[model samples]
Target: MCKILFINNCQLYFIIYISLPTLEKDNEIIDIDPFTVFGLFNKSSMKEINRKSIIKYIADEFNINAKIPTSFNSIPVLNNQNATFYNFIGYRNDSDIDDLWELFSSALDYSKNPTQANRDKVSKFFDRVINQKGNGNSKITMGLYWISPDTFLNLDSRNTWYIYEAGKIPDNIVSILPKVEEKISANKYFDIMKKISEYLKSSASNLKNFKELSFEAWRYSEEINHKEKSKKVQSQRDDKGSGLADEDVDTIHYWIYTPGEGARKWDEFYEKGIMGIGWEKIGDLNQYSTKEEMKKAMKEKINPNGSFMNDALATWQFVYEMKKGDIIFVKKGRTQIIGRGVVVSDYYFDTTLDSEFPNLRNVKWTHKGEWEHPGQAITKTLTDITPFTNYVEKLEALFSEDNDGEIFKEQEIEYPIYDRNKFLEEVYMDEEDYDTLLELVRNKKNVILQGPPGVGKTYAAKRLAYSMMGVKDQTRIMMVQFHQSYSYEDFIEGFRPSITDGGFEIKKGSFYNFCKKAADDIENEYFFIIDEINRGNISKIFGELFMLIENDKRGNSLQLLYSNEKFFVPKNIYIIGMMNTADRSLAFIDYALRRRFAFFEIKPGFKSKGFSIYTKQLNNKKLNSLIECVERLNNVIADDETLGEGFLIGHSYFCNIDEVNDKVLSNIVEYELIPLIKEYWFDEPSKVKEWADYLRSAIK
Candidate 1:
């Protein structure tokens, strides 16, 4: 945390980067004002100072027992009835504090040891908490995170930036936080924290505690905050608005709308895969101003109905609000999921269709197979299941096997790009190198990670996308391997034999598809990662895309030789190419293509603190010695004129210390290490044997 404090008129004024509120000092009150810290917020003025000294000052002045509070209200009462309670946490007054404590404490107790009677109490308590003031809701969440460091990540702009920066949160978690500065309710905050903890535990399973992980998240958030300030200044100069709003990014909404009454028309609906509301008599909703008006009109025309207002609203939504790209699931009497499809067209009234299904929307059916239903039946003809977390997960699972489920066509919604901090935590690379990689990618738009095998080039590429997007959106990322057979026809756009037509058809390649998707959401970033980039004929594969791949040439129209269609690589699409430097058989990338991409050399990360932390957890002397031996071997390899840097073994081979043992080490040495060394010194058999023997001796 950075703070700039200066003395003005003999009064101390503090400008804080991270909040360090105040503590009891010799039974005297010392309170600091609490304000929202934003990514672009800036304060000018100060001297560099130690944060520890500030804490020490408070500690030296007063002595307070360092223990968890016995009761929730004790957090305020024991700390001297100060307004800092409201500043630090969300306690409005004594009465509010008492009321919050009673509810919060009961919920906590129920969570610790829940029973059938109090099973729903946690949800009830969360609802009460969420209904509090927005600022207070956040402040209280921060306090909760502080008390349960093991379970929760703090809810603040800084912490949120960190989580987004890491780009490692699960897809479901990303679904919850779709935009920047999105207000999180109490239940949402808890849900986000739970997911984050689960992710942290999996990624950093070797760690004894999450303290370092939490600090890293905060520190990274601060880093992003600084970057955001710089970006703000640049954006101001560039005359660009702050990208896209949360609503601008299209999302996949799940809906369960039964086709006909009692689902007798389930098979026909499944076959058609269309979503429509049955209120044929209500007429087209575009003519009506409000649901009430429509309902009144419906009453006069149809004469008797039961609970028609709700049905009218559903019809209105089906006609006007249900968007393209929103996913639909047709259900039948809670027994089975009949079909799944995406709404491809806006609602329309088709008199030619069956009278029972006149009000309809076109759907691109992805799956028509029966899937075992997971939840209770939905009665409404058009129900948005996006808000129901449980239902959403179940529906997502039902379509989880679909290979193309993540990517959707153009929609009028916005999505976030990756976060940098999260990328560093996941990839075992130094902060300096990680920051450098990010800069290269930002400036160049296309970056090639070239290094020895096992340097994590491929692993880093996908995560790099996630970190940049700030969301784990697989749809925004596309990966393909380049081989000798890969060609321009395969990469950009080419004519292919049509299976259905029995003739040549113009097929859109992955890159072409990706560019179109990116062009749709020009505000968001998309990633195209190519593995073994040097293995393919770069010149042949890129073709005219070579010109379009350049940053300046982006959006420059060109006529494809095959398709003869106007095409342009979108500005939002970033290219990440991976090349194994040790593969001597492959030629260097074409000079033209090389000039377009920023080349980043990824080295074996043996000296990284993350690797050190990982190895320390193994707590085995032999494992430590093995690392030392590998470092020595790397030095020797680097010194060798014939087998220089490219041939040096990567840390990834030695990173798996979790299952390390004499047998595992021996297998790695004999099979992997020795073979790599032999290839490095193929002309010198004696030298290869010497290094292999020495390597084997270290493992023994």
Candidate 2:
């Protein structure tokens, strides 16, 4: 016997041996059941899939006297035709059927006789299998194994990987078996299967078929992949605390869930404070280790028509993807929102509940009364609508009246007193410059604050609005970031999936809704702030609003493309946009937009009285030394011909630290500052290294 270690770190090995002595020579009785291995692989950790019944159904379809089909898809695996699963298992070919009936009859003959001539003739179809969809193995090979699991082994990639290269590759296999990569001839395949049968018989008097073992091999490969995926989503869970506040709410998944048809289970779920999904016959969703596995079971037992894709996805998300504190918007049909809540418990399978809907999760339903939906919710049973902020906001609006504070407690917007002095003190900007910014917005209806990153551009923009109003009113402010994908449809108004009828409808955009809100309160000021304003196609995003956003065009109406409604930029709406000058990729502002708005430059405030006073209060000697180094570095950046004052480091990087410890300072140098330095002087590696060393030494 020889043991070969394929992966040293994992301690994985594949053993090769000539043969093993029979169990009769040993002291103990042994059991060689592939089904046992298969069960252990999936059933021990999760719910067991009914593999036997499905195998029985498939085997029954290939009986010797079974009628031949016109096309391979005419053969039903779990009563579904043209399923991609058949292609994956290498059972169905998309093409290459010259005479379907004759080929079927020949395959049956080869399975029964197992003669070299029959094998030679039938194996010809192996390469002819269209694209060799999965495993790249002969479909005939898989079929024969299904027909006689004990006498034949599929030898697909899944089976071979488990045996030769996968984690702790199976031990004590007979010699002369095919290599892992070799596509065995029929005789070679028979010899390998016979060896497997012999190895099993040696352990016990009773023998089981290799069908269960084949399933086990597939499970082994599947489990490894599932574990890797589990690791990636671990951060998505807030295992400690109630998943509330900024500490725990790093990422929140917003979901829309429906209680059975017409929300028949709404009362039961609301009363019980539990949400549930059906497909009980497939057993606990936990049994299926992955969504693909759950989807397979759904195809087999529940939705055989293969419409189960979306339902299975929703089921999998409910069981695994969803974490506590994720919002769940509940609705009955298309146009009505029935309730809103936060998921408060991990998923559970309750057999006592309606069997059709056994999978459940506990929910703290904040509101239960009906409210007219602004648009038609998706037709799916469960959907993750986190990406659609407009849709999520509109749905959240319906619950504002009945909101019991459970969901919005953390989001309770604060209207802290903010004015000219407060802004100057915090933003590190002098009163004169701050007043200039305020006047720019007052005169030009639209003003963009452009500066290097971390210059307090966004910060100062917000405070400028508050000072202009003489009070910080979050209700009068709206903020969004512009990306390469931001469009007029997203920024203003365009057709989205209809909320009332599941078709396209003119769903109002954020700016349009904010404008309406501001229009109603004409006496108060409303600020619409766009961060990273130059990242998007300004002309495309502003669309027809370019003219309306002009100081003179306020309240001048224009027909919208989709709704054709006479929409106008409300006079009370003040547009405050921020752009990063250091971003080399930003294009010049749209010429049309440039004419309508005033542009203000914001330099770093490191030398200002406010920043000096603030840093002196901290009294960190190392921080002051670091600031001196940054000031020196900023001089070189400003003097560089390719770069300018826009590329200078901003004071905000040093602003937010409550504790000025060496570790935090070092992190800012190594992780944050060094990366930016490298990009700033990308061609000058020595310059990057010198400054990098200079910055790191100050922290030390």
Candidate 3:
């Protein structure tokens, strides 16, 4: 027998020719040196030789599968008999390559045939599989390539270097890779895997062959390195650039959550500098291998009731789905929103935390204040509100760098308890008017709903406040009618006799009390609505607050009259004042307060879509004709020199579609509109009679 021997780099390699017995017997040893046989190729050629022949030969000697073994019998041998992805060999010596293949097969087919206990087993196995490859092992790439040739690319030191040279990695990853002395960290490896997965799944690029793409990338990277070494000058930055591209950013979901029972620990969360949920019995979610397993654990422990599954699902989302960089909004009680932040760390179980809220994530809170109570309270412990575009826009605005604590400004008024549109329709107001009114209120921070009597100014004012708030939270809203007797002492703070006891107490007026309430809950919005605002002494009742009510002066402190305490109207508090324009005896509003408030004229709403819809629902031809007559009467009233458009008989007189008929219409015409007409044209009795005859004919 003869053995062919080759020697290089202080290591020996021999090719055995055992069957050549004649040559062995003759001692015909070919004395040709292996260097002469192989030829003196440069270091670069040697690297290629090492990559193609030496590395592949070593892998082959270990019986690497031909064309990726489909069955267990065709797989390469595993040195550790019981080696598995989840755990190291544990006393079982009989386990073989088939067991390992079974594990990998389960992982490969995991998404399709998933088991509750093994839900996270695949991800856990992934790390183990990578770790099991040992240092500088290229078999991991081989396995991935075998599984999905089109999806997975090879990962090794050389290929990693290729990717690095291309400058397509995050600075953190770039910083860590070269410093890794033993093995790449699971985080870095997983990050790379995520990047590759994203690139392959991107809809922008149509790439099929991952292997070829990887080879080209490596080759190009090598060329770049060579050019840099030869020229000895800093090269132009690669177009590939570092880190994830804008399109490559993971689809991040924004969520709102209230922690603990009734948000008891919400203050603690903001104080503790963290955001979290309350499910400690389930233990650390990170310890679970799969979401299904975590859910199983939750189902076993948690009270399985209505929305339990949904709550558990939200918990799963919090633990697993919520990645670092996701936005989180914290809701306190049902009225206030606070602590807007970006998740800065992975989900962790804080054992030191009380049982109420132990599952936590680190967050960098960007803003903290009361958001004008957005509609109804956030009921869900965790809710994804990404589907609502308006909420998203508001969220973006709140999180912006220059945002001056403007939170929950715009709100969607779709609540089960409050039928905003129905209320508007009842008041004969249209959606366009409602939106405009809300916008005016939002921008100006102070607004007045002024219109003629019977135009639904008072009715529309409260509904308008509710619509702007997104919920009809009566606690956040207070209504006070201004009158001749209503003074600074009564509207603001003053000493008043207490009814409960025979003593005097310092009484907090409606405005003062409302401002204090607003200040206490700065995270929520409060409304101080004044009906017949012009009926009171405009400058007297408001006093020093007249200047403070300006949008810019909100939150600026001023000395009070009675208590002498420094006070200011909170930014979260919005003032909505109602004025009856037909009451011309009332003094004109102080110009100082006039500029501060946005005056929205509440018209008769005869041409309003709400009125049209209401009339259509009633479907009364006579009533419709009555509306036309009222419109004609309004034109005549508007043309009058004494009684102008402001004094026109409003649609509110004909608004009660449910109650309006010949009798109710006649009563309104005879007792209401006739009297108003008599007052307007007392001198021109014929003019009043003409309009009354016209109105009476419609009711007839």
Off by over 4 Å in 1: 1-339, 342-418
Q: Please tell me which predicted candidate would have the highest lDDT against the true structure.
A: 2
Clashing pairs in 2: 46-287, 47-287, 149-210, 375-499, 375-500, 376-499, 376-500
Q: Residue 568 of model 2: what lDDT? A: 90
Compared with the true structure, the alpha-carbon lDDT of candidate 1 equals 0.64
Residue 70's C-alpha lDDT in candidate 3?
20
Q: Model 3 off-target regions past 4 Å?
A: 1-427, 498-503
**What does the lDDT read for residue 131 in candidate 1?**
52
lDDT of 1 by residue, 1-700 (tens): 1131221112222432333323223323223222121101112111113233333333333453454222121011111222233233333433433445455555556546656455356556445544555334445545444445454445544455555656644555567663434445545655665565565567544333345555666445544544454344333322101111123333445678777876677667657766666666655454455567667767856766655787777765675456677788878776678777878886666646757667888887777667778746667667877655345656767876654556433344444555766676557899999889889998899999999888888878878877888886756777788899999888887787654347877777768877887998899899988988889999899887888899888889999888688999888889999999888887455888789999998898888877777887877777677778878988998999876887678888876556778987888788888898888888989988888778778866
TM-score of each: 0.46, 0.49, 0.41
What pairs collide in candidate 3? 119-290, 120-289, 120-290, 370-523, 371-523, 375-470, 375-471
Off by over 4 Å in 2: 1-330, 333-414, 469-472, 496-503
| Poorest lDDT segment (10 consecutive residues) of candidate 3 | 236-245
Mind giving the per-residue lDDT tens digits that candidate 3 earns over 137-168?
Answer: 24444344445545444564555565565565
Judging by TM-score, tell me the better candidate of 1 and 2.
2
Q: Which candidate order results from sorting by lDDT in descending order?
A: 2, 1, 3
